[model samples]
Target: MPPSTISRVINATNGRDGELVTSQQCIDHIRTQRVNNIGHECISIIRHFQSMTANDKFGLPFAPFTGVNHHRQSTLLGCALLADEQEDTFVWLFKEWLKCMHGIEPDAIITDQDRAMCNAIHSVFPTTRHRYCYWHMQKHIIDHLPTLVSRYGEQFQRYWGLWCNSSSIEQCEGYWVEMKEKFDINEEGDGWLQTVYKCREHWVPCYLKDSFFAGMRSSQRSESINAFFDGYVNSQTQLHEFVTQYKKVVTHRRLSEAHEDFKSLNTKSVMLLGHPIEIQAGEMYTRNMFDVFHTEFKGFGTEFCEELRKDIVEYKVCKFTDRGKWEVVTYE
Candidate 1:
């Protein structure tokens, strides 16, 4: 998250030593400094090093992280302002964020495929699951392989979608082969496809389904949070005025969150399924999560249930296509 704000004076006092450094070791040394009053919610970041573009109006050191609250609304989870997009700078930023969070780490962190940010995440929070933004990945594919997209648009999406929607790791691997052959691309070559494919575990959905991302599998949510201040501050926003405006931004966002909480508590979503599982899920989850569960469950229809083995009496419930879904239950 790019720590953002109104005035240079505000962002200048992040911690001790002012983190002044020239060498890598010295850069690492200042990372120990405690960040000042950045504020918090839970976990997630705003504008995480996407393309590393600088600006005179916005997007400097202020790194805002967004998270989902109990009301299932996006909430701010603290932030930091950095001097640059260097790997060390990000490491220091992440370290400061960790301190701000009381040394607690998120279960999963999603961001754009910035190599520097990715490396910093691995160095600072190795145990956390880092997912690449599929939105960014798609943009990158079009940017890197314009010819492939323009020429083989439909066919490419067919294989690409299949690969992305694979139900298991083995199936994902098989689809990868088919995709490569469909395009007649070489696996050993150092092209865009080959390079991105090497890091499949990071971007692939089938590889990430087991992780509890709370339905946020991409960094797209962060994109909206990044724009949370668009109306408040613009390209010409002065450093000093930004401080006052930022307070309004925070207050407005908090008020919006409270409004969402009020609505969530007062309303009831229409029960689409009325099934016991759906009913139970509605009782347990917030409106947004229950809606997600309802949509997924609606796609689940058991075409048949057959006994796989009489000894264990394992019954497998699956759809005719199997591509839709497959569920197995064992009765002993």
Candidate 2:
């Protein structure tokens, strides 16, 4: 906004007032999805504010609040134009968002490891589970541990995968020790590794696997949403231009979703497996969600489940491989 436009925000006649506005239509869309999937254990909130008004977060004004629906689609819950990215600014923004949603707090929220944002979330939403974007941390490791990444490469990545996918906290800890020993990582010199380990509960998978994140593990979905805006807005986009283009972006997403919903409802999905469960899932789930369920069902062909002798409801699910990957799930 120009000096003249910013000056008359309070008393302007031509619809210029506050920096923030939450759309009721977006809230209704999210509320409808919530009512439909009330059984889900986790409903996550994600805030993305990159490459919007300016390159840096402080200069950027747009914060797109998104949530995952039953279809695993990123639904826009609300949006805000912050004056700045200060801790106070973020706190106020989150509080306003909470009010707009009728004080219904989300089960979890995902964001990059920005100190101010983290602090703000902690202050405002104290009980909400907070998780950091692993991809952001991955880039941090690449930048900080370039020598280790370059020397080990794929071997490092394989070990990294094993460590990240640890089945239990103890297993994760054991893998961390093993990784340090195998790679000869210096205990005294690797400050970044130590720092990240202290905050492992926020980003590591095993610590968060039990919590529902709608199967989201990173802010990549936010990146995808930002990608959609590439054609409409760029660095040269002024505040007014951005506001105009944003409506188009939202409209495009709605049209795309409507198209998908139409296909999901009208077409018959061919079942790969002849299981009764597959048929039931196809009927119950959205097209994308059914596809996910079908893929997992296909994985059952590669794995074998063994029931515990003492308990009928307890079983071990595993693939008979040299890698020895397996998991246990209990039914009530």
Candidate 3:
């Protein structure tokens, strides 16, 4: 039998000692018996880093991971060991984590619109800009107002496009007013729109366009991390099994990233647009990023100037279609 199976049997049989049956007992056994030296090693590493002169200006940076769901009965997944999704708990976690890092805070954080999480973030990292996950926001809008999408499909698409792509606060405000009037959202007493509007600073791109968010407008990366972990371990995984599996997962991920990096450094991407700009981008960017740039570069040729004013220029940008339908917009 595998070591994991043997360990599971031992845990189930109270380990022949009759003291490691409960979740707490299992946790204590793992912490004290297995990883006690590892915990001490981590503290020693932290202390060594702190003592180094080169590290004086830089603090130990870490990312927050929350809402990790696992089976309640599993020893490794129990609430007593893992942090709960509560405001006070989150605040305490942040405080304890920050204490080790010498008070350095993250510039921005992207999360779902959980009131407790948002409140905890604000309380602990007051200066950090909190952004709502765009994917989550869109899902909420669709889920809450299914009729809007079903009945006014075209109008909703237009509204969504305008809301996402608006470059400035003025433009967003103008588009929002038009959207509300055309949809009769205000007159219909749409509570969802009202609530979202009240927290516009957290989600609206116009308000956050100038903030340095490292180009992140969603918590999709965090979700992807969770998904990666799901491939290695499930809810029923024991504490020791989880630790062993986690190391394997991390090793696999690191190897994959290293492979991608080697490929990026060694290989050259084929130019799509055959333009000088595209050639430059192909040299500078990774294969995936060059593809995105090539797509945008191709669209630039399709746009034409319709009208030019002293302060504003009107451009008709063509959509990707055989028919010559264009979107006209004024830029000042």
lDDT of 3 at 187: 45
RMSD to the hidden true structure, all candidates: 17.8, 18.9, 14.5
Candidate 1 error regions (>4 Å): 1-62, 144-164, 174-188, 272-275, 297-310, 316-332
What Cα-based lDDT does every candidate model obtain?
0.73, 0.76, 0.67
For model 2, the run of ten residues with the poorest summed lDDT:
44-53
Tens digits of per-residue lDDT, candidate 2, 10-99, equal 345447546433354445666798798875534322123333424433356667877776667777666787888889999999999899
Best candidate (score: lDDT): 2
Question: Model 3, 268-294: lDDT tens per residue?
Answer: 888665778778888887665666677
Q: After aligning candidate 2 to the native by TM-score, how far in Å is the CA of 297 from where it should be? A: 0.9
As a TM-score, model 2 comes out at 0.67
Clash number for each model: 15, 0, 0
Candidate ranking under lDDT, highest first, comes to 2, 1, 3
